[model samples]
Target: MKIRKNTLLIMMILLTVTFMFANTKNVSAKVTFNKTSKSITKGKNYTIKISGVKSKNIKKVKLKYNKKIIKVKKLRKNKYRITGKKKGKTTLKATVKYLLFDYTPAVKTIKCKINVKNKAAKKKKTNNKKNNDSEENIKPEIDWGENNIDKLIAQIEQSKTYKGTLYKLNDYTVFNKGEDGGEDQYGLITSPFYSTIDWYSKKDYDKIMNEVKRIVKESKITDDMIDEEKAYRIGRYMVKHIDYDYSVYGQRIYETLFDKKTVCAGYSVTYALICRYIGIDCDFVHTSGFYIDGQNMNHAWNYIKLGDYYYVVDLTDAYCGQKYDITGPFFRESGYVDSKQMSYIDEKYKTSDYTKDHKVDNISHYMRCKKNGDMSQTLTDSELYNLPE
Candidate 1:
């Protein structure tokens, strides 16, 4: 009896130790900066990269530092370029809010100390910030072959299969076209002819473009129709023909054309394509962080510029109507518009109501293509298309 009691006490001690070890979980995550300290000449740029966070997981990245010591800008998800502005010392505090386990959002911050030296401040310092923004110096790692913003926007505008791909894509750095010509990490280009699916997708691309024109003709969209009427008709026609298929390549235009189904990206790409054939001013605006049906994710939508203000035309959100019943920000109305009454992109965004807003940091996108999303909604002229004031 004495021996058994001693053995039992030992076993209990060992079990308690094991449980304590198991409880040591990394809740905040291990955030690290490449350089803990650095010294650089004024006007020279120093790169500081953060580790322990993936690009997709990053919700929002912010830098806290004195602007007088350096001018910093985000080079990518994990990197920052800091140019010394004057002879001084400052610390770069980078805070990153990222999703944990791809579900829960968490934040962590790391700091880097820096010392700047040189007579760089001798030049007129009053307009340095403006000058830095206005000037474009091509760098090797993230090169935009074209430096002029206006010219680049014009060039891309002319290249879309339709006008709103611009709105759907909206300056997501991939559109910035670094030296590799807009290739993303997934080895895919924004266009079928660009890369990834290049040669094999040509026929598919041709098929979709031809189909877009045919669909417009079938809709009886006359040249005399106002832009709003034409857009409403074409948008409804797109929703009627295509069902929502949440899958890989759902963001690509050709995929939606061939499959007759796609996620929000596919809708944006197709809508942009159709608008191109019909002659309309449109583009795509995307957010890395968004919410749909109670889940946080990324989303894309169509935007149109009408005079002084920008209007939205999210056909994807319209999937909420009498057809696709996904129960997202998409209302029963023909398309997405906020209370501001511009147009419906995502009514949940830019609204005064925080009750439904799921904005976590800056992360806005879908975690997965909703596999079971259904669609039967169509514009059918029953919905109203309110043009921008």
Candidate 2:
């Protein structure tokens, strides 16, 4: 009986030692993050994988982020994946639990740092601040091209597709080799073809020229008017007379003059046409502007040369459905009557690509075609013939 008791004590000691060793070795797993840190752009995705989870009895692996729970997807035998969901600095822990032989569970955790960058968001914020500052700090200038005057005159002369004015001024005509002889034709010598005339029928073309003549005659605009005065008078007349048309569609010039209902295009084109007829240098300036719908659409306006400097003339905004003495001292206070015309326009059209109205001391920037944008949005047959219903 004594021997048996000694043997029993030895067996109990050995069993206890074995149990402790087994407990210490309960499903040991090595966890490592595929990446310690990662950067991702906003609205983009980044994934991290954890490997070396050697425990076969692993019940599950979990990843927590942004106050949300994520069940790690098993990539293979002992690998897991965690996808990031938010921007900024983030820390995540891979928690793994597994059952031991005795059915008891053990937990192991490993941590990793992740940084996500939202460059797009940051850029937008910076751009807004810069745009506000640019209005005053930046000066606006137009390239006007290598042959600005000749190009402008040619555009105007070629615009007479229906043939009211064979020549607005003698300078508008260039010698071209015709079947008869080298005849003086409209447009530049380099580009003599009437490329924009296909859209107008004889009647429509006649109406366009006749309307231009009518505006000149009615406004009493003559060669006696200086360029600066002519530009201002035209702006004032269009704003006071032309009603802002929100619904009028199709022919812009016709609707502007005949119906007295037109949008920016009508206002701008009418201004350009009148300017060209009266010998004031002007052109249509097109730009991409945010509309009431919060979308960027192609918008139209005008730029005119006044003395040695150029100015932006936005008639659509100037009218404001009221008449004011454009020549009064009140109008002359800011060197531009537009400050009295509409304040909203003063803000909306202040982009560096548009105008530099805040710094009225400097000449305004021309809303010229930047890169891929078209330099001209003339109501040519190529652009206007196919209406978008």
Candidate 3:
């Protein structure tokens, strides 16, 4: 009986130990990048590694980067070499996928900031004392936070060297009213218009603005209209009024507001300004997409925020009836979503959601059947504007 009791006690102890062992969690391998951040010369190769990961345990290591801008090469086991071909800041991510051994598959990731500097440009900057002296007088450029956009627009309009491009406005006080410390690209001035003409003078600027206001007044756009309603009316107005042609003053503010014959730049700029006039936060989106002839070209458009979602307005494409049927910013083909225009949604404006639910069916057929189609259905006050019922 004593022997039986001893055996039973030993069995109970063994069972308790087995239960605890079965419930124990698997230990994870500590993975870390060799360096948290790095700055390297452009066109030079640099080594990056995941220190704590075992080569045998790793199924494979993958490096994610902008292939167009940066290049990566895998060297020995658990090591990678990265080279930035362009002068900019890009994030390098190394994902170490582990091989499951008596446990669920676990993965580890390490990220390192890679800043590629142009060595020659830096040296030139150091040598240029005149530029440094003048920079103190020059105000800094900003990405956002200027409350008076109308005043900024007026200032840009009045500049004799406006250069149709937003480049000059990047440094002006009214435009860059705030500080930006995010990335180099966060400092660039962006606009939907592509013309490179000068702003002319205050007389021309006032005339153009007065004409714009007259059109808005004629269209009867008021504060009572929601953002979507305002945008729809403005887009429709541009399509009806503006012709796809060049003017003597060029395809820009003067041509768009006065002559009524302008290209994508004029159409997009007019739409953006009209929306802004009616208290809608709208901006220009520069994109590259297929033109009417199936040829890829740089296009200009506008993006507006309605309710909580953001949608794109390609007035040029819509006016030509090329992209009038697509639901959002993408074209639908064979039940799949395809990007029609590559907009500035990457780390610049944070408009990535421009591609979500952006598909509509029978685009080519619809456009072929109905040239210069009426897109009143697509830009309805209820559907596009999200009016409160």
Winning model by TM-score: 3
Give per-residue CA lDDT, model 1, range 1-389, as digits (tens): 99999999999999987765443236354667878899888766776778765556778888899998889876457667778898899998988887765366677788899999994343542624333431122111322232222234333422222222221122221222223354322112332222122122323434654566577767656443445556666776777788876655556766777778888878876676566445565554455445568775666766543322234557776774547432233212213334323333344344555213222211111111122231112122222232111
Error of 3 at 342 (Å): 1.8
Better of 1 and 2 by TM-score: 2
For candidate 3, the per-residue lDDT at 28 reads: 42
The deviation in Å at residue 36 for candidate 1 is 80
State the displacement of the C-alpha of residue 258, model 2, in Å, after optimal TM-score superposition. 1.5
Which ten residues in a row are the worst by lDDT in model 2?
Answer: 189-198
Model 3 residue pairs with clashes = none
Candidate 2: deviation at residue 381, Å? 39
Q: Write the per-residue lDDT of candidate 2 for residues 1-389, one digit (tens) a residue.
A: 99999999999999999986676464444445666666655443344555444336667777665543222344433344444345567677767776556666767786777665644532332434435442223322212232223334434422222332232222212222223343333231100122211123335545765666566556544342345544565666676677876677842565678888788777776677677656665555444434547754445566565433455666665664334223221112124434323333323345674344223324222222222254222112222222121
CA lDDT of 43 in candidate 3? 71
Deviating ranges (above 4 Å) for candidate 2: 1-199, 289-298, 321-389
Per-candidate clash tally: 30, 0, 0
Q: By lDDT, highest first, what's the ranking?
A: 1, 3, 2
